[model samples]
Target: MSNVINIWCIVRENRSVFSVTIGTNNNIFDLKVSIKDRRSNYFAKFDADDLTLWRVNIASSVLRNKDTAIEPYLNDKLEEPADTIGDTFHNVEGSNVRVVVEVPVTTASVENLANLFSQMNVSGSSASENASASPFTFFTELVKIAPNHVQKLYQDIIFEKITNPEYFLRNDKIQLGNFAPNGTASVYLRDNPTPTDTEDNVQNLFNDLMLSLPNFGKKLIVKDTHNNPYLDRLKPDLSVFLEEDVRDGTCIPMFVQTLLEVKKKKSESGLADEDKGQLIDYMNVLIQHQQLREHFALFLSDGFRFYVMVYERNNRQYKEFITNFITGLRLFYILLRYDSSYTKMADPRSIRFYKSPGTYTNIYLKEFLGLGTSSRVYKVDYNNTQAALKYTQSGNAHHEAQILRFLNENNVANIPNYITHDGHSIIISPVCKRIRNQFRAHHALQLLRLLSRIHSKRVFHRDVRPSNILLDINNDSVVLVDWGAAIRDPPNEQVLYEGTISFASPDILNNNLESHRPTATDDLHSFVRTMYILHNPSKMPIIPDGNLATKARVIREYWDDSVDVKLAGPLWEEMVNAAKNGDYGILEKCCSIFKS
Candidate 1:
């Protein structure tokens, strides 16, 4: 019969230590979780990784090697006979023997140990007598032998401090005085009797201590009626920290993380080959067409992930158009990913090619006509009002039609409305004449005001050039059209990629391959260019000649004396002189000449 020895396990870290005893037959793994359970907090701060266990020798006082193994006799149900043990048993030759087993505490290790303990059935009592022999029973008995309240408190406090300092601070009045009956600490808030400065002093000390700790700091709060600290809920004034760092820790970051995780999981799930092929086909279509770029770019969310692109359309080489096409696709995909229900198809038929028109069944079409890449424009009638309609053969007409329908549903004013469609994706609005004369600055300002209104609702008119802006003869108003690239600014960032080359901002041109962010500044730049075009009908602005180094540099040097200064020489001289002298005020003043 093998001798049965009672082994006491003590796990220590920092300022705390926990101990449990079990029959010698039980593996070291069994003790790890027992110590963790004894140390973990019930309400907060519970990581399995923090638990650690090791052995110490009672005599000669040295730690044992972690790999050392101890065997227990199966037949020996009781503790080893003290009188029968020899000198060799007490001291192994050339070996440093210890009482405890050293094992790194990890979730995996704890689980393995728990499994081993279950198999060994290392109960405090043997099965022979009137007692039950189970691993848990033994564990409970061992915990009672050397209870560790200090260790438990240390673990709880540290975990709470790291994982959720806010919660820890809020519950500061609560005193975790002692271990409860269940081997966990009981915490309760104390009511002040004398109302002394003790609490304040304690808080000050804690604050001072935390100041030296990394990623820990004190937050100011208002005092309540009982002189207790009340958390300040008011938003702080804009400061360096507020401007540079993230404020809300929950929603925006969580959403982005969730989106990335979802994509990763989907990829790992092994989507059907056919589905993958279809997505690839859609991406190919995005790569092939310029118009498709505008259509798809609107769908992307503020962040540049969740993208799409068309590679081929009608077997055409879409290389030249692919830049904008991929950008459009990325925008659209992001939008769909963020809020699929709002942006995705409510009816499958909406995606199919259909055309119809009638007064009673007229659909509000203003929202649907996104900016089209193609040059061709059409005319349609709705609600007895004629509207200019642009048609592009390269992109999704159904999506554009849906946008028009959405605009109507939301009752967005001044936008061309969409009518019914059965065979073709057609839109109807108040008919407008194209500005035969070159775009002027005043016209650009009027357009900017309209765009400002749209952007106030967080809508970005990605494509805003002279061609996209229409002049209504009946209303004598400049009606903005084409939302094909329109996008809603996300919570934290602005929309990207929605403009034409003639009025495209430097940022847009420099970041041409991907969807560069669209800003109010970009729109301002476009407006300025439009004004320049109207003033100088005989000549256009040219990008400065230089070996392009950086995007910012290219933009700064754009329109550097590449054109003949004589054709509209005065305006050219003013612009060149202002640019050469780095006088933005003069340049802006000159730009004002084209207004209206």
Candidate 2:
């Protein structure tokens, strides 16, 4: 019990206190990971390994009460990765923050990068002339490496090998086998390559190649990685990492600046599907932890051939395909392409949003229905007519006003016949807050149709919960509200969280962040869960947790006699299957089940 301690840390940036329950025996690197995970969004672009932890000098200054500018006394730095927390810093029980964290600079946003690239504006002729002849089969247009940079790589690396052979041990490239592995041997051979001369030979070759490169030396080192920080069962052949970033608990992907992936010889499995998959998997983990849009990987397709792989992604947050909808995150590699390729609506700079005060000023607000930091909803008597009015700062991209305008234009049902909006909010005919304990089959069907209509317009309500859905008592339907988190066009990859977690889909909650996107199927899952929440208000979240297995079990066993389970239950199963298998056609059928 003495080994474990609760350490409170203060982030020097915003003076936010970060709490962690870790073992005193645990290294400094473990403590950093705990801090990062606790407030991932806050440090989305930061590498925790780069954070500077100082033993809080409570006797000098404090995080909240800035008595001194110089980072309080006792300024004893927790510098060594091998040193244990308890052995280094003395702990006080909530009397003062025991650790001070210094966050490094965050990476630039994708939009800013896009603007910079547009400013550079490479000519079409030069772009075509400079495109490299890539060895990977499916790889597309890659940004041409500058001739000087390419020359640097060749001179500093290739020439290093050519000139200094005696320093580097010689290996026979001819001895490297050219055997192509089919899927049958993939699982066994990849796991246990003890019998293969090729794998070990290639691994050594990869290590030597990275070691010889000018990019890696004393400050940077080459290593073969094993464990993952992001929970993906992936291991790179060799990772080029900053030596300072490596520790007993440090993960390679978190620190790896560039990774090396290799195959013995040119074969079906080499630069083709299998080898590329590993690189892509690693890219997912790296991008999540590194918070960067692009990374590079070194690929050795054969005994003597090496090619550079550039993994690039645009800023868009939803992915779509004509063939099938892959519900989770999917990345497409292309150089120079940005979110400019998507709809103007997805690009926020172009959207026209009314933010100033509206024309109508004569309004007597009676009762307050809801209130938040930037938003409020109230029952008001406006122009001598009773209306439910809501107002807030606009997040205009697929926002409440925008979505409502689109739905209104499309004539989607349950939208109020009379609705008015101006600067920041909307006024609509009063509707009941939500259906209480008596949620019905008819309401279920109406909710299904409402969501179907929204999806039909390519508008997905990222947050679909009971509060966001109001009952149209007179019409026996529902009005879907709160469109601030909605998105339109699909993207190649998305890295932001836009919706509530408990009602989130398996893809969002699955811990493996390889896939994090909003989908029509995500809505279906939320839609079904919303019905359950409506029927049983006491059992709040319905699922109550985001653990994948437990959520599945809870969803599977959930049955309510209050609503028509025969219609809703089968619909849920079909929708869930569609999400997993990319069978979106089944979604229409899933909705039709409510009609049946």
Candidate 3:
């Protein structure tokens, strides 16, 4: 009789549904072949010489080996088996044959088993019913993962889509309902209304419409409408709207159009009697529309009326002011792009226009002044003193504010004091005295010391240069600036290349080092360069001769000029002899040159 070789079968890393089978007479090699045959894509190729098989008991002790073919002895004790056994038989001669095979559980097998079970008509539902239930259950589960604000925003978008289905169907209308919850709305006006039914009237209409709706715990959105394509000669002015509270009941008002006050006044003054009569006729037709009456009600309210005005200033000057403001607030610009609802109404009372402030335009002190690429600096009087202001147009005003706060918290001396940010501009440390070159070395050294200290504290100044080092003349010391590129070392990953080119070491230039891992060696190189520039007016290191010379000559020239001034031309001959014989001992004789 053939000996039965019971074996355990296991499968791994499979994602599909399949079945596994085991036989009492199958060996480990036969099991592998059977599994491969069942799963056509799964093949196990093993070295025949290294193949070893062991039959393990419930306690993980080896019961049998393939090499040692032990025969079944009568009345031998069997190991404790799992509960899912197929059969146990007793022969007529009273011999027992027990078969046991273990099936291993795995992720793939579970998924496949699930798929197979799903296909079976076990009770009531078909496969299609089970499939349909998955999406609804998945969506319910997904809602748990969504953020509250995002969920609210999505609901607002859905509401808008439901209310204005035609707008989406038109294909030309840009759907802006998603952006409405942030307090603004955009609508494409198909036609411009009469003069009386202006943009302000339309805005008032939207305001009243929103006010009519229940509060619902969310802020109502203001609406604006512009002409479709917006390039036509009859370009419709955008109508903006806001809501108001009512005593007993709520009602919606139509949009009120805001016209340039100067143009309106000029038209009223220049009109002839007949033209005035025609204007009256046009006004009568506009006043009759229910949309116009609803909008006019909002115009009557103190907060909902809109008007446009212009100051008697040159357009160029106003443009320059706006440009300067935008340049100073670059971070804010970015913020606006990401989140566009931010708006600040300009106050005419606080406005001031100018050409340029010459004292603030010193090019050499650009870094110290925090003057950016635009080279324009604005000063606002705070507590009776002028403070320099830096603007970030990219909309990270809070980030800039946090950086300023960090500087202040550290009590870092010699740095320009951060004053305040007016949401659009950053007020920086004021310049106390006239800047000069005399403070360059001291400032550079102070900066170096600060950098070394920061590094000792595990900080790296990735952007170290003259521009980032500021001099406070009142204290006569230097303060390191531009923490934008500064970071903690080693573990912090540096993604961008930062720092000035001239002061950046060879490693930085070659992109050989990672960010936040700058060493003291690079700092030392920069310090030496700055010192050399300060000592020499030309700013380049003085090389005695243009050619590569002997070590003796190199030692004599680079060390001390005093030795050559005293000993005359005979040192050249000594250098030549040392070079010819490759004698370093003679070069050591010239060590006295550098001793001084």
Per-model TM-score, in order, reads 0.31, 0.33, 0.28
Across 1-596, the per-residue lDDT of candidate 1 in tens digits comes to: 43344334332222222334333434433434444555455312333333333233432222222221122101111122222223213332322323332233211211223233322221111112112111110110011101122233222211111222122123233321222333211111112111224444433332332222222122311111112111011111110111111233211110111111001112323322232222222222222211222222111111112222222223422211112222332332233333322122221111322333342343322212222223223333444666544444444455556666766776766566776444334555665555535345555556655555665666655555544456666655666665555555544543333334435555555553134554555555555454454443322233232222232244333333344322134665665454334344555565456535
Q: Per-residue lDDT for 268-311 in model 2, tens only?
A: 33244345434444444444433333433333234333434333
Best by TM-score: 2
Provide the overall lDDT of each model, using Cα atoms, as 2-decimal numbers. 0.34, 0.47, 0.31
Whose lDDT is higher: candidate 2's or candidate 3's? 2
What would the TM-score be for candidate 1 when compared with the true structure? 0.31
Candidate 3, 1-596: lDDT as tens digits: 33343333222122122333554444444544554565544432222212222222221111223222122111122222321222221221111112122222111211122222222101111122111111000000001111212222222211111122222224333232232232322121112222333545544543443333333232223333233211111122222222331112221111122211101212322322232222122222222211112211011111122221111112211000111211212222221222222111111112122124322322111111222321123334555666654444433344445655665667655555776554434556654432234454345445545654554656554544434444555677665554443444546454444333334444443442223345545554444333332322122112222221221233233223233321123653463344234344453333222212
Task: Locate the minimum summed-lDDT window of 10 residues in model 3.
Answer: 133-142
> What's the TM for model 3?
0.28
RMSD of each: 34.7, 25.7, 32.4
Q: In candidate 2, residue 560 scores what lDDT? A: 24
Pick the lDDT winner: 2
